[model samples]
Target: QKEVEQDPGPLSVPEGAIVSLNCTYSNSAFQYFMWYRQYSRKGPELLMYTYSSGNKEDGRFTAQVDKSSKYISLFIRDSQPSDSATYLCAILDYGGATNKLIFGTGTLLAVQP
Candidate 1:
């Protein structure tokens, strides 16, 4: 099975709205990192890195993970149209192999002005 699973959202939100994104996994080896991705000139860029369970906040963005439940999330406060993009969740299995990375299909977010 895939190591991580994220919502393939075509989610729309108005300006200043709070946006929530989510993912889930079924691997214990996923204790390493949960990465958030946004589109770049080349392709998907690693936007945020979160470790273990609990929440990590960076400015208007927050990444949360629940190791016990195998759940992960990202929250955006005061959403903006510039934030519109396809976001992906990635997991690294350090316990399994050397840099075995897995990624979700991605969720598309559209913040309307």
Candidate 2:
């Protein structure tokens, strides 16, 4: 039998609701991090964040970043089932001349209608 240490979640919430998702990192060497929304099990992209300690809002979404705490959060308002997917917390480390991006295990969310 394969060992399962941790399981990804299916965090279910109702449609038209508000939700907050948080992630924490232990690495201080990371240059920055971003929140990626993945759909249909496809690979997530880097068309996301540029971080600083504060809240950034656009439309129905808000991102909270705290460098000292190594914490970040994504808040969504007026959620929909169409938004169901895996959310990943990613950090890019530009060490030396090479750029390395690391990803969290990802948390799957399902917004129920």
Candidate 3:
């Protein structure tokens, strides 16, 4: 299996809906999990980062990691049109600087009016 797997979701929902985006990984060495939000062609902005497991919350965004299940998820509460963007999950391997990062294909989220 690929190191990480995620639905490249062009998931559309009306404004005010709660959106849930997720990713699954097959690697056991990945310890750092991150959630990024990107608008159009711009680079991603770090939304949340966790060293291991548990949940992290920031504003309308919440990130959850379950190392035992190798799964991660981002929950956006009270969605808005401005929240329309691609969400990407990234994992940092412990290999060193050369290890770089592994990214999901990214889920395209559209919060409609």
lDDT for each residue of candidate 2 in 1-113, tens digit (9 for 90 to 100): 21111135768999999977777777666556677888885888543575657777777778777879777777889999887888877777666797866677777889999
lDDT per residue as tens, model 3, 27-89: 877889999899998999988999888999999999999999999999999999999999999
- Give lDDT tens digits, candidate 1, residues 20-54: 99989988767755555575554777778887888
Please list the C-alpha lDDT of all candidates, in the order they appear: 0.82, 0.73, 0.92
Give the top-scoring candidate (TM-score): 3
How close is every model to the real structure, measured as TM-score?
A: 0.89, 0.83, 0.95
Would you give me the overall lDDT of model 1?
A: 0.82
Error of 2 at 105 (Å): 0.7
Off by over 4 Å in 3: 97-99
- State residue 44's C-alpha deviation in candidate 1, in Å: 1.5
Q: Which residue pairs in model 3 clash with each other? A: none
Which one wins on lDDT? 3
In model 2, where do residues sit more than 4 Å from their true spots?
1-7
